[model samples]
Target: MMSILKADLLKVKRKWFWLLVFLGPFGVIALQLVNYGVRYDYLMQQEPDVWAGLLDNINMFVAPALLLGMTILASQIAAIEHQQSSWKQLLSLPVQRGYVFLSKLAVAAIMIFISSTLLFIGTVFFGIGLHFGLDIPFLAVIKNSYYPFFAGIPILCLQVWLSVVMQNQAFPLAAGVFGAVFSMTAAFAAPDWIPWKWPLLVGEHDPIWYAVAGMITGSVILIAGLMDFVRREVLT
Candidate 1:
């Protein structure tokens, strides 16, 4: 598994995969920078809690960005195999088919984790730069940066599963885009069980519950996807 994972990493080293991971958080922070830059005084004056307001603004895009990123990451990873006609070659190896699927999933998850970490650091620095306060709200910052990622586990798994099973990347990519759009509207009319709504639920009174549910639901989806993957005949 470790060897397979290492090979997967090497496969994309020259593809600027890490750069994409970095861009996810960087893009989020950059947008906030522009937002705060334009109305620094106005926002600061209007916001009762500077850090809270900044976090709220940042949260607005995090879920959609995360969903889109995950979709692309998953689709790109699977596309490598499809484009190269490497699925049969990969499955013919001594390793279990499940390991290959798990390795792909791990790579996507690790990339998202790195992106989330960058988001945490970027948020702290971005907030400090804005002079929100010398006494930073570290807990709030952590939640704003990571809670959504945690809550997005189902979307990540679903994207990966869709990417891996379907040879056509368009389906997975479309699902991701639709999920991103759904996340934005979820707060108003979406049900609590909708996975797309989980990420944006960070502002809810019991946000942790949604995160936990996403993970549990994601685990089930992962298992089901793996079963189908393991049983499928690789023609290519």
Candidate 2:
């Protein structure tokens, strides 16, 4: 199992994967900074409200980048097996297929979480540097920022399952793009009852109950995807 994980890490060491993992969050932060700058004059005129500010920042910056990054990470992990023709090689190893799938899922989820953390840190730093004031509740920002990463687990599993099943790079990437766009749209159009709503929309009104529910949904999807993958017969 450790060897499988190490092998997966080696696969992820490629330049493209690191580029997406790092640059994706950096780009999101940069865009958020820009948006903040554009709204600086307006925000300055009004008293800073922590919850409102945090929500605004999330809506503008964090969610979109997070979903996109997770999609890329998930797709690339599956792509490594297909692109390098190592799927069969890995499968033939003595480890359980479930273990192999879980390892990949773990790595993908960790990478996405790391990227999300970086983005959160960058946002905080940007807020401080710009003198956005300490009016923002540190706890609220931390909670909202971290919650989606957890909520993203099921989506990450879904993406990995889709990537593995399809074995085509483009489809997974497209799915990621579509999921990111759609989640944001759905959250805005009618937040209630949308599966994509909780993870993509972060704010004070974002109940802990909803996040808990999202976590459950994500976990179930991931487990189901893993089971499906384990039962799948690989021709290669």
lDDT of each: 0.88, 0.73
lDDT of 1 by residue, 120-190 (tens): 99999888897766899898888777888888998888898999988888889998999998888888878
lDDT of 2 by residue, 1-236 (tens): 77878878887776487777778668876776676668876765564564466456655555667778888778778877787788888788889998898888888877877776776677677777876576656666666677777766667777888887786678888878887887767655755555555676543365565567668888898789888988988824
Going through the candidates in the order shown, the clash numbers are 0, 0
Candidate no. 1 TM-score: 0.96
User: Which lDDT value does model 1 have at 158?
Assistant: 88
RMSD of each: 1.4, 2.4
Clashing pairs in 2: none
- At residue 221, candidate 1 shows an lDDT of 91
Error of 2 at 25 (Å): 2.5
